[model samples]
Target: MAQTGWDDGQALIPPDMYTDWTAVALLLLTAAPLAIVVGTAGFFIWKQKRSSQR
Candidate 1:
């Protein structure tokens, strides 16, 4: 079997270029619930105002 080596001639990215995927995942998870709460509250408030005006 031939031993394969990295192509050193190619440009390489810095390690930090790979941003923390875990943090992104956590943020998305947290945002879902928060968005649901805000949306639900706004919906109820709008409904109440609409009914009162009718």
Candidate 2:
């Protein structure tokens, strides 16, 4: 069989699937840190209250 250009199979991804996801990506990036900070602060506050009650 003669070699076709597609034999290498380079163009797998469709163009529309390439739409900008930077905002969504950034939201995820920031949300993780924010959640961590809030969770840590809440845990400390809870620990303080629990110790005070003893």
Candidate 3:
């Protein structure tokens, strides 16, 4: 008889699920500043409208 050392079994992950981390990170970076710029502009516009109404 011969010994095969050990067996670790099959992998848990499926083969079709791949991710592109670089693109995800780049998207997050771009979204954060764009969100801030749009939010600031909206706030100032709202303030201007409020002050004009008084």
- Candidate 1 lDDT over residue span 1-54, tens digit each: 562343454547643367789999999999999999999999999999999999
Candidate 3 has an lDDT of 0.82
Checking candidate 3 for backbone clashes, the offending pairs are none
Q: Quick one: RMSD of model 1?
A: 7.5
Output the worst ten-in-a-row residue range by lDDT, candidate 3: 3-12
Predicted model with the maximum lDDT: 2
Listed in order, each prediction's TM-score against the native is 0.67, 0.62, 0.69
Candidate 1 stretches with Cα past 4 Å from truth are 1-15
Query: Among all windows of ten consecutive residues in candidate 1, which has the lowest summed lDDT?
Result: 2-11
Question: Pick by TM-score: which candidate is best?
Answer: 3
For each candidate, the alpha-carbon lDDT, in order, equals: 0.82, 0.84, 0.82
